[model samples]
Target chain A: MIVAAAKPWEEIMASLHGMHKVLVVGCGGCVAVCLAGGEKEAGIMASTLRMQRKLQGEPVETEEITLTRQCDPEYVRELGKKLEGVDGILSLACGVGVQVIAEHYPNIWVAPALNTKFAGATLEHGSWEERCGLCGDCVLGQTGGICPIIRCAKSLLNGPCGGSQDGKCEVKPNECAWNLIYERMGRLGRLNQLLEVAEAKDWSQGRDGGPRRVVREDVKLDD
Target chain B: MSNRDFAPKIVAFCCYYCAYSAADLAGSLRLQYPPTVRLIEQPCSGKIDIRLLLQAFEAGADGVYVAGCLEGDCHFLQGNIRAKKRVNAAKKILDKIGVGGERLEMFNLSGSMGPRFAAIATEMTERILRLGPSPLSTADKGEEGKAE
Candidate 1:
């Protein structure tokens, strides 16, 4: 799931400076699952914004809404009816959700209240860690299910690099991903595979392809 | 913001298992405490979210508190601990935004602590009396800072 953190309160307040009426939209998607921009959190943000505006002697009128999935056009369209008197929109969703809303309503000012962090998993309550780098390819079959592209500091295919010390990464005190991979592979009696010659990953499958899009013709309806 | 007879309004979110019973015990014991406090009962202190505290101040509460079971004594295991963490987190924002973080607090006690409950009420009332009304409240002097 995509994890996000709210932008600094000062930054949000500054962006909403002169706005009179704004709608705070929360997404019941990845963000809500990650506890960043759920309906409850969006209400908290709206209330904080209202108080800040009031403190400045310019109270803002904020309405809160939570859509099923802001990334989907069907749910983003729900804001059409809500945009009537709204001067701006403060979205508490992931970047994709925020962008979708902004693209749908080109006339209204749309601002993201969250800094979308990464493709990650909830490690525990109130904590999440980046798990997938979204390299447009999967190599978990070879890496013992650990993502070297994201977990390893250097993204090294054949790692446990020179900086690995006592099973810890040199970049931080965290356990080295390569070490964990080695242990898991060792347990599976597949450690020999880690020494196999590896080819450079296809960069085009990633950002180098310049904003790639998927055409799932099977799922699309004819226009 | 200072007045000789200014009585600050305090909104206390009391957990039913502990703080609520503690308040009730205080009453049974004929304790004398300030009447400025308004207690709202909750199943667990963990249910007291940040918005509830902020709304209390928004609604003219001079001070807000979450009275939960003593640490490790919450009805829902870690509810009191969670509430304490949330209160601390909200306090930072309140302090940053000039609402005076000291106005908001989290108190922990057991159901049998009747005297402690009354003492906390008096302590909170006196502290609030010193701090005066919340600036966010829309009372006469705070009307200039109205939200609507």
Candidate 2:
């Protein structure tokens, strides 16, 4: 899931400056599971905005709503009725959700409440760690299910860059991804796979190819 | 209200297993404590979340505190511990929102500690009195809200 954190209070406040009424939108998808932007968070944001603005003597009114998933058109369009008198939208969704709302509305002012961090997995109840780089490549099978592109600080294709100390990455406090991969491969009796030299990844398959879109002809709906 | 006559509105979220019972004991003993504290009983301190804590302040609470079982004595094991972390998180938000983190606190005590509960009430009341009213509270009271 994509993990994100709320932006600073001042920045969020500045974005909605001069707006008397605003709609705060939360996504019930990845941001919800990550505990960043969800129904509860939307309430907190709305309450804080109302209280803080009132305290500041601006007194902006806010309404909170959490869409099923802000990334999809179906859920984004559901917000139309609620936008009647809203001066702006404070989106608590990820970057994709914020863009979807902006692209759909066109004329409404939209601002992101969260700084989209990374494609990550929950390490524990409140801890999240980046796990996928979204490199548009499949090498997890060869690397023993850990994507070195993200887990490794250097994104080394072949093996550890030799800066690893006590299984921890030299560049960061996290465990060396190559070290984890080596151990995982060893435990699976597939250590022999590490002997082959890996070639450089295809840059065109990733962000270098520009914005990505997937169209499934089989699931196409006649418009 | 004038500075000298300021009475802080303190909200205490007391866990049933410990703090709530302790408050009850204090009442039975007729111990003297500030009447400013408004108690809300909870199943466990862990039941308290950031939203609830912030809402208390948003609702004009000058100060708020969470009272739970003494560290390891929580009826549900780590409820008090979880509450402690949440209180800290809320404190950070409070500080960020210019309300001052000193306005919120977390206390750990067993159900047998009636005197201790009274002491905490006095201590919290004194602390809030020293800090004056919450900026949010002052806003509600129609004063120019300013956090000291």
DockQ of each: 0.53, 0.53
Docking class of 1: medium
Instruction: Estimate, for each residue in B53-146, the C-alpha lDDT of model 1 and write its tens digit.
Output: 8888777788999999999887789999999988998888788777889999999999999999999999999998888777676433555434
Clashing pairs for model 1 are none
> Whose lDDT is greatest here?
2
Q: Please, what are the lDDT tens digits per residue for candidate 2 over residues B1-148? A: 6778888899999999999999999999999999999999999999999889999998889999999999889899999999999899889888777788899999999999999999999999999999998888667656443332
User: Which sections of candidate 2 miss by over 4 Å?
Assistant: B141-148
**What lDDT tens digits, residue by residue, belong to model 1 across residues A77-182?**
9999999889999999999998999899999999899999999998898899999999988889889899899999999887778999999999988889999999
RMSD of each: 2.0, 2.9
Q: Which tens-of-lDDT digit does each residue in A1-223 have in candidate 2? A: 9999999999999999999999999999999999999999998888888877877777887888999999999999999999989999999999999999999999999999999999999989989999899988778988999999999999998999889998999998999999999999999999999998898888677887679878899899989
lDDT of 1 at A131: 95
Error of 2 at A115 (Å): 1.0
What number of backbone clashes does candidate 2 have, counting pairs of residues 3 or more apart or in separate chains?
0
